[model samples]
Target: MAKITNETKRYPTDLTDEEWTLIQPFLPKVARRGCRPQADLREVLNALRYLARSGGGWRMLPHDFPPWQTVYW
Candidate 1:
């Protein structure tokens, strides 16, 4: 498994290495022809977990998360 290098802050809902390894295969591969994604999937997933756990509006997501729109889409 690749090392998670950009994890700036730990969140309760953030997936551990084992969890991410298990779920990684189910996520779609990045498209090579289109513009590359700006954020990592792990970051996106963490943002999602934060949203789900906090029951907060998209616009209210903490700054540590990716932009709310990124996670929403």
Candidate 2:
């Protein structure tokens, strides 16, 4: 897991380390054949949770989360 830099702002919906650990196993594993790197599952989950909790539109998601299209995918 990548160490979160202190510079990265934390969002209200961001999962705690324990929460992420519990859910990490259920997330899909990265395919070895992909040319591009996989997006961080924690960030993706955080984005989804933010959307669910805020009831915000995809375009209106805060800049802190991954791009809306990525989360949508």
Candidate 3:
């Protein structure tokens, strides 16, 4: 797994190190010929989990997350 640079959990929705390792391989990765992904995959998942758990609108996501558009897409 790529090292998770931000280890501190800022919210209840963030992933733990063990959980991140198990899930990381399943997430889509950056294409070899395209621009690299702009947002961190782990953060995106955390934002998604927060949305699911809280039943919040995409726009309502906390600022610490990637933009709503990014997560929505």
Candidate 4:
């Protein structure tokens, strides 16, 4: 039997370049696109990962990321 690490159990959330291309049109967009965009799905997923690793309070997360409450449940 193989011993699975925590990393192995986590969901595969990394979006590939091609995969991102397909989902880009459908995901919500932030205003002011001329300069740069913030809060893409990748970032949100990353934040969720960090929460899982640290086991911290959702509200403790910085406001820049999505509500941890939503991500947890």
Candidate 5:
């Protein structure tokens, strides 16, 4: 595997493949299946960071993280 580069370095929001792989084991097994598949961990974490760094309410997070309402409260 290639070494981590500046652009690929983990931020408070980003996750590397290996990190994702480790977490994959714990991902919830949901009941929904689409014709396509998606894993949006980065999107959600980034949203979380936006809230954390900005000191904004979690409801201020982008719609990408749908649990934002509960997160805020």
Candidate 6:
């Protein structure tokens, strides 16, 4: 799979660096064991924000964001 990058702002729902800084402290840290996470938390959050703001179906999510299943569950 190609590497995913959260460096660019592709949507209006994406968090600004300052916003992420304020929100980052509240998110859970990665586990030291078990399966690693498949997606970036910030990207997932942005997907969610886009879905909420647009009121679109999960499967209809744009190609730029992570897969819909990743954001849905």
lDDT scores in order? 0.81, 0.79, 0.83, 0.56, 0.54, 0.83
Ranking by lDDT: 3, 6, 1, 2, 4, 5
**Higher-ranked by TM-score: 3 or 5:** 3
Please give, for residues 1-73, the per-residue lDDT of candidate 1 as tens digits. 2355337347788777777888999999989798988888988898898889989899998887789899999
RMSD to true structure for each model, in Å: 2.9, 2.5, 2.5, 9.6, 5.9, 3.8
For model 1, the run of ten residues with the poorest summed lDDT: 1-10
> lDDT of candidate 5 vs native?
0.54
lDDT of 3 by residue, 1-73 (tens): 2344346677787888889988878877779996888888888888999999999998899998999999999
Q: Hey, what RMSD does candidate 5 come out at? A: 5.9
Full-model lDDT, candidate 3: 0.83
Off by over 4 Å in 2: 2-9
Write one digit per residue (lDDT tens) for candidate 5, span 26-66: 86554576533243544454556667777877656655453
Q: Which 10-residue window in model 6 sums to the lowest lDDT? A: 1-10
How does model 2 score by TM-score?
Answer: 0.82
The estimated TM-scores of all candidates read 0.84, 0.82, 0.85, 0.37, 0.42, 0.84
- Colliding pairs, model 1: none
Evaluation by TM-score, superior candidate among 3 and 4:
3
Model 1 ranges with Cα > 4 A deviation: 1-9
